[model samples]
Target chain A: MRIIVPIKQVPETTNVKMDPVTGTMVREGVEAIINPLDLYAIEAAAQLKEKFGSKIVTISMGPAKAEEALREAIAMGCDEAILLTDKAFAGADTWATSYTLAQAIRRIGEFDLILCGERATDGDTGQVGPGIAAWLDLPFATYVSKIESIQDGEIIVERMVENGYEMLSMPMPCLLTVVKEINYPRLPSLKGKIAAKQKQVAYWGTAEIGAQPNNIGLKGSPTRVVKIATPQVARFGKIVQPKDEHELNRALDELIDMLKQKAIL
Target chain B: MEYKGVWILGEQDEGRIKLVTLELLKRGRALADKRNVPLTAILLGEKIDAESLKKLGHYGADQVIVVEHPVLRYYLPEPYLNVCKVLIEKHHPEIMIASATTTGRSLMPALAVKCATGLTADCTELDIEEETGNLIQTRPAIGGNILATIKTPVHRPQMATVRPHSNKPLEPDPQRQAQIIYEKVDENLLGSRVKRIGFKANPAETASIQEADVVVAGGKGFKKAENFKMVHQLANLLNGAVGASRDAVDLGWAPYAAQVGLSGKTVSPKFYLAIGISGSVQHLAGIKTAEMIAAINNDPEAQIFQVTDFGIVADLFEVAPLLIEKLRNHLPDKEA
Candidate 1:
């Protein structure tokens, strides 16, 4: 069996800052890490590899620096790594990103399963996973909480539902977008880190993947960030400070009256 | 044109339809009505048991497309997507609406790609342009610090997935009726990918924080996981659910399921009790839709107070017990 995990490099949420003037995320000095959710996908892939004698390949589509994310996935026990980086890929939305990824996956050839995080934190779109599955014309599942069993060309798993969970099984060559509840990700070992440092990561650009220029980047993206601006903060009411019991009672009464006036009580 | 209507993907689990599907139908029907087009609902399930297709008409559907297949009893992305894709290709609708549930979230993106169109996910608001008949999709951006309105002007079938509970489901009209279109299942496709092995429903008693009417949410101010028990107790007493700020979840004081923020579940319960949470834009985005919001914190200047309908300037540790005690005494037994 072969498992492919698609990972993403995202600006660390804690260090992420917005440029007030430009209304864009300040990324110049922010540290980039493998998207936290993608770690689960990598882990799930590694577990499958361990159990089924499968190979785990980590793929990422981002800037050149995104090689670091692939390296980290290698350190986490991925057998191979591929980085899809090119100037043309910049500013791509989920659709473009998924298209590029689908081409990359096709280039990688045979894979029994494709795994992805439910959504990337930066985009919070959760579209790429299913989008890839769609492009590949494969069966896919999202918000997968647990994998019960996989054998004989079929994969069985638990899908998280609003009220409860349901068991689902799909044939091989399926895509799965996992949630955090699936499994706890493992830390990189010393041996794994050393091996990752020595491993060469493959790089693929749009031309290498045979993708048309019109469908591989910002120009291909149908949706655009027409405008980005901070939402206006609503004005809050004045704070009432009460000095004595009488004043406290009056403030409480006034508050209730206001609630009544608004018909919120 | 083979297809002359708008279609809604109705999501159902455990014999009950999801609320968001109804909400989407309500909005879809309105869109169809505005365009002077038929509103159709696509119901895919196995042994659906009930005559729920009529409910679609009650909520304003001109037709209900029913696909009953045992293979679809449980959601296997392959078969479900295949069925829908075939249906869509055969009958191309002008617009498609789906709930942003786990299934819909999984299916719509893939379906959109198959159709070679664009999709806006987790949209808070959606409307059709009166002149151009394009979808105006509105959603939060930059961790909810910004709101973006997107449009897919060139797409053939405009598609948008809306968050659950964001919009109200229309009231059912028993007198309404619609044509029920039945589609035969392709046995070969159904037998292809995905097989149903077993099903385990989550214990309902576990209580999903997303459904809580009153959420006792804690934040970094809680200091430790042990302190979260107070929140749990209060939630238990109130028959609500426990929630946590992203800070608390990141601090490992709570599980991700209990988190309320941009990355977590967006909840709009009737009453939200935020304990010691200093509201960030992301956190506020998840809870701003609540009907009533109350905040308790030691810091009087906390941002939570700004959006809260009621603010209590007191230490959560102290105020929480007092509020719980007061509610126990003042409220009815069921509420308590």
Candidate 2:
């Protein structure tokens, strides 16, 4: 089996801060990491490799810096790494982004499975995975938590629904967006780290993938961001807490009174 | 092709219709009246009850178009998409709406691609432009830092999937009625490529935090998984459901279903209590609709305190026992 895993480089969600005056993202200290959810996809792919011997080719769509994300995947026992980057690919939305990825997948033909993270933390829309499947016309599943088995030209898995899970069996040449519960990601071993250092990262651009000019970038995106504004987070109401015992009793009384008045008790 | 009516994709299971679908039906009603078009609901399921049908009418649907099949009972996108694709191509409604759920999100984007249309996901606000008659879709983006208003200017059947709890369902009027249109589904097209073996509901789903009026959420300040028991204990005392910040969930202290954040479920509860949580915008976005928020964190400048109405600058471990003891003493029999 030939499995292709798509990974992304995203801003460290915790450290992201908005400039109060300019309302622009302050990306100074936000270190880039392989999207947290994609780690599970990598782990799932490695588990499959261990069970059934196969080659793992990891792909990423970002600037040259995204090569680091690909290298990290190589350290996790991926056989090959492909980085799709170009000035033309900037500002692409999910639809255009998926189109670019589909072109790259076409370039890396003869693949049995395409696996990706459930969603990116920065862009939580989760549209890219399904959008890619649509572009490539492959059966796909999102929020996949468990892989039951790989049997007779198909893969069985459990999809995470609202409060439960459903067992689905799709043919082998499919795409999957996995959740964190899929597997526990393993740490890169010393041998794997050295292999990552020696790994050759292949870089592809629009011309390399033979992508149409208009359908590869911002020009191809259907939706337009007409406006962007920081959501105002003014405190809801006054904060009330007691300073001492007397105040504690008074605060408790006031709370009970308010609830009673609201008929919530 | 003339785009005419307003369409709402009413999602359902065997017997019950989803709350988000009813919420969309209510909104669809107003949009239909504004455009002077009939509001139609397209439902796909094995068996949909009359109560669910009436509720759809009660919320604002004028017509209910159903595609029934045994395979439709479990959602696999292929069949639902096939049924909806055919109906949409034939009807060519001006606007189409579906709930942004596990099912809707999976189905809509593919269908949108199939129909060569545009779609907006997890929208917090939906409106129509008076002059252009375009759908105005607004949603929080870039980790809830900014709200972006997007428009699909050229696409017909302007489509969107709204966030689940963003809108409330209108009161169901049993007296209301709908013209139920049953469309025959092509059995051969349904479940051809992908197959569903079985499905089971997680028992924890029954205690849905979105439905809880009071949510007691904890963060990494709980230290470890074992110390997290106090959160549940406090929830028990308050007659509330237990919630978790993404940090707690990431640390494996709580289940993903309990996670309260942008990537997880949005909650609009009456009273929300945060313990040891330094509120990130991602977490704060979900609870923004919470009526009353209280925070207990040792850090006086913890961001959680900024959003809540009541904030206590103290160790949560110490505060937990005191609040529990006081609540027990104040009202022994009180439920909420």
* Candidate maximizing TM-score: 2
lDDT score of residue A10 within candidate 1: 83
Candidate 1 chain B — worst ten consecutive residues by lDDT sum? B327-336
TM-score of the second chain, cand. 1 = 0.91
Instruction: Please write out the lDDT profile of model 1 over residues B272-300, one tens digit for every residue.
Output: 77888988766876786677777777788
Model 1 C-alpha lDDT per residue in residues A1-265, reported as the tens digit of each score: 8899999998766335444345445557767889888999999988888888889989999888899999999999999999999999998878889999999999899999999998887677899999998888887778888988888888888877665666778778899989887888999989889979999999889888988898878787766655555554342534444455455455445544554464433
lDDT of 2 by residue, B22-119 (tens): 88887788788878889999888888887677668777889999888887887877788788889998999989988888887888888877776778
Q: After superposition, how far is residue A47 of candidate 1 from its true place, in Å?
A: 4.0
> How does each model score on TM-score?
0.88, 0.92
